[model samples]
Target: MTSELSWLRRRADKRAEIGPWELREGLRSRSSELRALLEERKLEHPQGTPEGNRVHRFADEALSELENAERALTHAHQRYKVGSHVAVGQIHIDTAHNLLLRLSRPSEIVSMMPGILAIVQSRLSSDDPRRARVEAIAQSPESIGEPERETILDAVGVARQASIRENLRVRSFVNIVGWVAGCLAVAAVLVALMGAVFEDMVPLCFTPYRGLEVGGYVVVCPVAMNPDPKGGRDINESEASATTPADYLVIEIVGLVAAGIAAATTLRRIRGAVTPYNVPVVLALLKLPTGALTAVLGLLLMRGSFIPGLSALDSSAQIIAWATILGYSQQLFTRFVDTQAQSVLNAVSAPNAMPPPPSPPQGATSSAS
Candidate 1:
């Protein structure tokens, strides 16, 4: 009833409001959603709708509307108008073919649903699934037949079960990735703090920090390279005087190495399931966190050289530290998203009754009585 009303409501709406192209696409994509919903109702009470004559009336109306739509398309083509409705029909017809295949073998196409339901401004088939489901319902319970109904329901069940199996195979990897990322973030913070503290340890004698006076505090340089030529001292201690700071280069290297290892691990986990396109997708997202931390550390390194900042690098070290944490944090993000997606699928999997196998198109004269 809801589908019928919604279709009718959209019908009254203008071509401008909702293009025929989109209507066709929606039908193609939502065929299963409609079928699944209606199937449940039919199984509980396997008979035609309560409204008898209304079904006949709509059939007549649908036939008339189809003819008018055809005529409008022909006229648009003849006029060569960019606004021609026929071009939209052409698009819909092609889309219809794909939709038909999906309906026939839903298991093969369940993965495609996420793609189909995506935004496509127009529809491909003249007879949308919603309409077909309604018309099928309107026809006597015998029109679809008990046998065909059982077949459809069985197919729906199988398709759903296959999806469950596929997701279950990959779920553990997703969970592991999340937990590991959380742990890596904490570990990265502690390791970076220890590295920074090394910059302050002059008494221990590590690198140039072995002996130096920075601020009122005893500044210990970790490692100072070839000093600048412009300044003179036994060493370029002038710039090195203010305070000791961390070596950003080391920090960035550590972060990159950590993120790279993460990427490699993720790639291995997704190897079998992902297509070539997924490779680009996964790599691109992974780099977002890695590259961000790298740049942050690089920037901090430059800033630390000039400023009389606190021991260890400038505040940017802390910034890079957090960002690197996020770099590793991406593992958590992907796993979390996949888990949420799985939850939604689980919600839709259960059902009370099965759908019927869809019938082939009847002859032009109409045997839908």
Candidate 2:
């Protein structure tokens, strides 16, 4: 065992004197040396004595190191051959291929051997059996001219730039889609608020007299009416027929579009304060029927009646006017509105306790305590 260890140490020391080519030529002899040492260790350590076991371990380590050194030498020799003959681009390709093999399996050659593949493609002009060996070495034997290398690099650069441009275009398209979605959301909210402000403002049920005299036919104006016996009539035929219901509907739609723009503008201003970046603002005009329905529900919780002087206008006009103001002042109103909603919820949950007093007027100043 001691003799085996001394022999292994001498071989390891001799490894430092050999070049990669010389090492490659000596691989067979070295493998034989390892095999011989392993056999001697096994015969002497049949029962696995401590000294014999130590000799076996040392031989195994030496064998493993020798195998690794052989592979290193082979790769170094291959690279030397490639660098001396192949063009700079081809050399790069060969290096990349060698790295690929190290990282993956031999089966991965189809995808990992692009440089060798390119060389083969160029060699289609000549029918040489030796070209087959280039695949094993994973490099080209013939050096590519400067013009060919430049052409290959240019083509690769162009393809890379095209891919980058395509990515940018996709990103821009996504951003546009997101901005349009945001606009639609804003428009929907504005239309909803408008409907809520005017839900009860217009007369829903009405009556019109069709009775005619013998001499002259006559038509009575539409009069506002309700199904409830307790309800009172509020509007005359003149106001109801002055503009058709369809016209009012149209006005409401137009107002919603304008409100969407106003909302978008307000949002842009708020965003601008936080960041210096700017983009062209476009508003979505389409309004969903559900928005109008939701507005009807919102009307029940509104703070006050229509603003002063707005009463002269039609119901749709009045709604649009109020919606515009609310859109701009949403941030100011939302906080108090949420607090009031919570208060209402609390009052309902505890029916026995008295509801809290309404918040004090914003205009009223309290004396400092």
Candidate 3:
């Protein structure tokens, strides 16, 4: 019954929408046991077992399991991919500690950060045997008591609160997205319904019957809007009003906003590995389809016509133009998001798998400070 972050829960919901990662293959049972041990600390000595002997054996097994779990995570590239729409995978913090496999809390990234940090630190000091040095260091025990532990835990609680606040920001953006979509939908319905009711040939000097014919082409009181509202700069209002044919409008708005947010988020994630940006970027990207659709709606409205007439507006040319517009819009947004995401990812990657920069020559103060 391990409690997990709510964002992790939300992320899990997006996996199928993205795609599955094959990183979770094999070693499920081992992962389960490790999770239990980490949670319960249940590897105490049995009645006859020697305390030191039993603890040492347990530590060895734990280390081995940790190695295996870490290897699985790395090979799967899941830490990075978990956030990707393409990495459809499930994580159970209680039973699997899977969400930690995503790059949420750095301290909790046991297989990746803490272990690697410790190992790299150990390998650096080329003094005695590396194994001997690490073993001696590991043997050193801390002198913390209950009060200190409590204080540390309390600090952790505060940090977790910050994470909760970040999560709320994400939820807020979700609300914004839904609201934008809802507004477009409602406006379209309202305006269309109003127009349907008011079309008694009153606003027009002539109806479809009065439309004039010039040579092979016909142009008249076609009721097709006054000089085409959406076709020109002056008609932007008509194209952008809440009342536009909103399917495309909503999707397009969503796509532009989402793609933009995703691009920014991807960059932030890779560069600073700004953990807080994850939710916002994701929420924004989730809104992309809406943006794309909204833009499409604007195009449709630009090629304006009455409801009965719009059916005729559905020519192969119109359809192709619209499809091309929407498709290209989606692609443009995707490119930006991908580029930024990769940039951020590149930065977050092991900045240096090599040893730490050499300390200022013996007691010398370094300029790095």
Instruction: Report the number of the highest-lDDT candidate.
Output: 1
For each candidate, give its TM-score against the true structure. Answer: 0.29, 0.24, 0.32
Q: What is the overall TM-score of model 3 with all chains considered together?
A: 0.32
Most TM-score-accurate candidate = 3
- In order, the Cα lDDT scores of the candidates are 0.39, 0.37, 0.38
Q: Which regions of candidate 2 fall more than 4 Å away from where they truly are?
A: 1-143, 200-369
Per residue, candidate 3 scores C-alpha lDDT tens digits across 202-313 of 2211112222332221112222332232223433332223222323333334345544554454444333333323433453443355344544454445445533454323
Tell me the RMSD of model 2 versus the true structure. 30.3
For residues 254-308, what per-residue lDDT tens digits would candidate 1 score against the true structure? Answer: 4566566566666543323321012223343444344335433433443354334
Q: How do these models rank on TM-score, best leading?
A: 3, 1, 2
Candidate 3 wrong stretches, greater than 4 Å: 1-35, 38-40, 43-148, 200-369
Question: Of models 1 and 3, which has the larger TM-score?
Answer: 3
lDDT of 2 by residue, 36-57 (tens): 6455655666546775666556
**In model 2, what are the clashing residue pairs, if there are any?**
196-295
- Candidate RMSDs in Å, in order, are 18.7, 30.3, 14.3
From the highest lDDT down, the ranking of the candidates is 1, 3, 2
